[model samples]
Target: MIQSDTIHGIYGTEAAAPPKSQPMHLSMLPCDLKRHWGRCGITANFLATSTEIPSPAAASIISTVINEILENSVKYSAIDTKPIDVELSIRNNTVECEVKNWARLEDATIIDSYFKIIHDKDIEDLYFLQLEKTATDSNNASQIGLLGVMHDYPVTLGCRIQTTADPITPFQISVKAKIYLNEVTP
Candidate 1:
């Protein structure tokens, strides 16, 4: 069983989203991840309009980050029936996005390791390394969504993998990315 302690961790420096942040929570089936991909942008736009410092540019960044996370969630999800839960918290200049879904034990472990490697290694080096790997390997497609967002944006990412004793649904993976809202007027 994956230990409760080992399975949970914050990838970047910040451990939690802002305490007084306003939030928007959403849930949808795994199949809807692609079908409703536009939700990412919708969510982002909501962020832009909701904040005092509204910026369409910030919305774009937030949208990209949200898509990557939702894409990853769909890729690793274990059950079709379970809903993918997403939460967005906006506090001042910070917007935090979290996506959660149930996954098979193996995928859960893989994502957990992915987060650890990002924390341990230089992200740029790993990004280049992953690019090379993706170019050469057909079977082992490198998961680049998470990596690309981390590389391209000024965002902090985190992951939590939980293992349950229940046989029906044994693992759950949650990923969060915190984006610093763009200050430029849009």
Candidate 2:
């Protein structure tokens, strides 16, 4: 089924964007911490231009968003050797960005629950609540980038967190951002 907007599912369900028969840009970034950050911009630039988004502003917006996603993928990746998979595709009036990475089961549970709490209606409320939670956390970390992406941008978010029965096996997190083409163009 072609999902219209929000996508959230655990195992045994298709919790991803409608498959892109042929993605415009597909990249596999090996978990090279030193190099991954620099490569995100280069790849995002290619995605914006090669995808031919038309409006310069929209292109810039899309590129920035993709770069952010890439950065998050690098941060959350569980294993050093596993590669992060990113796909860019155009579907009807939306441009979709999907990033898949391996995550520790603990991290997967937290992120999955976070997604579940955010529905179409109360995202703003949850956004601020999350802000406080992250701020007070022991790591002194922040995930506001994602909350801002979900709140500030004209995009629909989807996620599929694939789990395994074996406790030793790492889980997979697939995050998708679907930006409406029409909302983006001025």
**Tens digit per residue, CA lDDT, model 1, 49-99:** 565545567777777788788778877888878888988777656777889
Q: Pick by TM-score: which candidate is best?
A: 1
The C-alpha stretches of model 2 lying farther than 4 A from their native spots are: 1-21, 33-36, 132-140, 164-169
Q: Which stretches of candidate 1 lie over 4 Å from their true place?
A: 7-21, 34-53, 182-186
Candidate 1 to truth, TM: 0.82
The deviation in Å at residue 117 for candidate 2 is 2.0
RMSD of each: 3.1, 5.4
89-169, model 2: which lDDT tens digit per residue? Answer: 876767888888777766677666666766444779878887889778876457766677877788777787776444553
lDDT to native, each model = 0.75, 0.71
| Per-model TM against the reference | 0.82, 0.77
Looking at model 2, residue 85 earns an lDDT score of 86
